[model samples]
Target: MRASLTPTDAPLRARLLALALAVAVLAAVAVVATVRAADRAAEKDRAQPGEPAAHAGEVTLRQPGRLLFRNLAWGPQRDRVSAVPLTATSGPRTSAPRDCLRFHAAAGTGVCLRATGGVVPGHEAVLLDARLRPVRAFPVPGTPTRARVSPSGRLVAWTVFVSGDSYAGGAFSTRTAVYDTRGGTLHSDLERFAVLKDGRRHRAADHNFWGVTFAADDSRFYATLATGGRTYLVAGDLASRTMRTLRENVECPSLSPDGTRVAFKKRVAGASADAPWRLHVLDLRTGRESALAERRSVDDQALWLDDRTLLYALPGDFGADLWSTPTAGGGAPRMAVRSAASPAVTG
Candidate 1:
């Protein structure tokens, strides 16, 4: 049974009802505003007139002299894996039927790191076949930043920014995973790899690794290791589960096609905190390092257009653009592709 309101209480009951109605109305308005905001953002992502054209088409790893990249030229195909002739990178693009924030390919294999739009945002590493179809997907622990497929297509590596974002202040945590594509064997954390620093076995809880570049042998690799507020380039051996530190202040190492040199970003002295890295190359045989002519701080793991030139992405009007420079440290940076990023040279 419920008690009835008296004449004096009637006014109080009416006031409560009015309050509830007002609350409901406000909530409805808020919902509408949020939805409208989302719609506006989606519309903005669609390509406007004058944007370089892209069309839905097949993208494959088997196409030689083809350049693959994540298309940033807004439209129905924005963020799709796209391909153009390597010699004609500025030409119209053919978009694949998949999305990746960062992508790389080699030997008929691809690694696509993408966002999984769940109630709580998530991410995944989706492996791709020569046809760019999903072979398998693996859960990534955080925001994807770097990805690579081994020269032989038998190994894959990816890095995620696990915590924080300030690279120069040592406030970030990174997780790198290397996997064998043949049977889905994954080394989920390179931190577990035994560290041989200063020619001695070292241990520290602060260790973090990222930006793995594989050698042609697949078992051998290179990556950046961070500890003690500094980063070092480390040579890794999957067969032994160990990494030997080579040089300091080197990040995002990319091995050359001939396996004789490495291209990387170095945090040089007297650079701004926000943009502290410069493009550089190291001769593995002589231990000589030289800064490339690209004066702008390059932050991407470079892709080798050939043994002679390097490709990387920088901020551009359309999110990002690919640029190339001579690896021998003498040339101007040339724009290779507009509104594109994460380039993979397929052949």
Candidate 2:
């Protein structure tokens, strides 16, 4: 009872339906192609080593392998030390290859020595050298906590922590020891300056002393003392055997390469371990203090490329990365290297 459509009208209706279906098909195909391209790009990014993105400003470290070095001002090019095996484990489970000793053109050459013999809780430490090989291996005593060489390459200092049981109860103490490479002897003058909590002279291995570093001339050194329910930075006179408090409530102090400043990390009150700490710089000459940079997470291992440039390790998802910032306070942090920690700037 309905009239039939003409042939021309019928063709037009069919063409419109066909076009709509074609458009829908094309859209689906485009979406699939886009998803595949994205997946490929992600794979490529992962395959690449180091940081996925490059940082602009300062210098770029694109060197391969486990090590990377970028010259900030240029003094002496770093001397590449031969890769030495550190572990006794055999087969495929062996420890990863690490630099036992490294020498910066500015910091001089040093041989990294592993603990040997009947040393309790053996640990590793580095001994500075004026030439290629070390003059002598410095004794770190107890368990080695931290080690560093003087800027002038005259002295090496480290922290040792000993834990044992006492008559009263369980006890623990930290000691700071320094070795004179030229003299080939360990100095005990500062070790005796440490005192017990009861105002008594500390005997061998009594109190805890950490974060030891020597000045340029090796005549003076600084270390952190945690005792009497407080932490303090103490500067020791090697010649006079006198100890003076430099700062309080600070830990992990790193002396600047020029020996004019000290950088340290501090914890804030009412803050948890998840909260970040502040990095502070103290002027040795004027006793003035200033905050160098504020980080969102914990930061340690600070080293000076020069008097004005500072380098430190930042925590990352996989590991730590090296970042550099200006000590004068300008510009954001730029990536110096990736997947490395304990950055000791050479040259």
Give per-model TM-scores. Answer: 0.93, 0.60
Best by lDDT: 1
Clashes of each: 0, 3
**Clashing pairs for predicted structure model 1, backbone only:** none
Candidate 2 structure, TM-score to reference: 0.60
Per-residue lDDT of 297 in model 1: 87
Across 1-347, the per-residue lDDT of candidate 1 in tens digits comes to: 99887898989989999999999999999999999999977975678777778999988999999999999997889999999997778889999989999999999999999999879989999999999999999999988899999999999999999997546667899999999988768999999889999889989999999889999988999999999988999999999999999999899999999999999999988999889999999999999999999999887899999989999999998799999999999979998999999999897
Evaluated at residue 200, the lDDT of candidate 2 is 46
The runs of at least 3 residues in candidate 2 whose Cα sits more than 4 Å from the true structure, single-residue gaps closed, are 1-98, 101-107, 111-121, 126-135, 138-143, 161-173, 188-190, 194-206, 274-276, 297-299
Stretches of model 1 off by over 4 angstroms after superposition: 1-18, 21-25, 28-31, 34-38, 41-45, 166-168
